[model samples]
Target: MTRLWIPFITLLSSALFTNAAQASADPLVTIQKKWAQCQYQRSQEKQQIYCFEQLIKRNQQALNSAPTRADLKVWLAINKSSLAGAQGGIGALSLVEEAKDLLEQVIDQAPETLDGSAYTSLGSLYYKVPGWPVGFGDDDKAEHMLKKALAINPNGIDPNYFYGDFLAEDGRKKEAIQYLTRAQKAPPRAERPLADQGRQQEIAAKLKELQ
Candidate 1:
């Protein structure tokens, strides 16, 4: 059986980071800034849920205002899925489904968005959620999509770290360590200081555990 690693510690550890100063005028920018804060600065799950909900509202508004930017869907799904992880109940399952649907569309409509973050996030979701009667978790598909993510972004911190985590959950700790190590060495994201630090911490914990 694959071990359950919450997506918050892995999947959402790499959210968008933008200049807060730039956010004052743009709604999407504001949403992205808050998204990073919700995931990185705020340690509490409930706070994350609240921040995401507020961001989702802004996202929906942005979607209505500027329908051409399909990229917003990616973050919308991510926050919902992150919220799902925070809420440990049957309701959380629905949020996962909603996220799944949104990601599937985002990949089809905008695979190139966010350097293929949709694929990376969706791939992680597959490995994190339950399969068959429960949800849509699948190790095999997780490998495929994760590889696709790497192809799009070989040096991306999120993809590398989650691929390592997937391998670790699948009992390939040795191989997992390889990816985790790379992720730990990944270059800093200028926009997302907090998210980078959080991921580095998670990577350190995972590396130590595996080593």
Candidate 2:
């Protein structure tokens, strides 16, 4: 009868949806675990650049397998950034450039997914690296990226602290003080104290010098 056929079709559709959901969830967990391991190795800071390169290769494999997942792409970006740092520390300029390109792609694709962490990273990159037309660092670009990040997440401590540090460096003392103070009072206090402390200390030292 038509009634019996309708129930069978509905049950089959539900089962298919359940299988697809499971399939989607499994790859994400695997990628996250691999990324976590990479971060853990980075925190140790003793791993050779080759070790990070190997990690990158693994992450690249995972990413190729699941190109549609934004989180995987973000994780891959973070690993690339770390690898860049490691390479730069060893004076490997070409590798650093390659990593920067990868990070740029991640930012272009998913600027909203990682709580604006990519913006903060890009801002730090511009702030720390030597600029074009003269030096490696570009304070103006750093300021713009940091501002965009704060606009995306006004209460984010990382952007607030970094922005305040940049302002302080530029001699905008009062505004720097306000931002640094806000950063110190922001939540996730335990995680951000280093930035807060560093900014507040710099502000204090600068204010003292001015007086």
Best by TM-score: 1
| Model 1: lDDT to the true structure | 0.77
Please, what is the TM-score per model?
A: 0.88, 0.59
Q: lDDT per prediction?
A: 0.77, 0.54
TM-score, model 2 to reference: 0.59
Residue-wise C-alpha lDDT for candidate 2, range 1-211, written one tens digit per residue: 0000000000000011256558455544444444434443344445645556776687778779878755555555555655656555335434435545655676788776556656666665566554554334577777887787788867765667667766766778788777766665656533223334444455465445534
Shift in Å, residue 64, candidate 1: 2.1
Candidate 1 stretches greater than 4 Å from native: 3-24
TM-score of 1: 0.88
Worst window of 10 by summed lDDT in candidate 2: 4-13
Clashing pairs in model 2, backbone N/Cα/C closer than 3 A = 129-136, 129-137, 130-135, 130-136, 130-137, 131-135, 131-136, 131-137
Cα misplacement distance, residue 83 of candidate 1 (Å)? 0.5
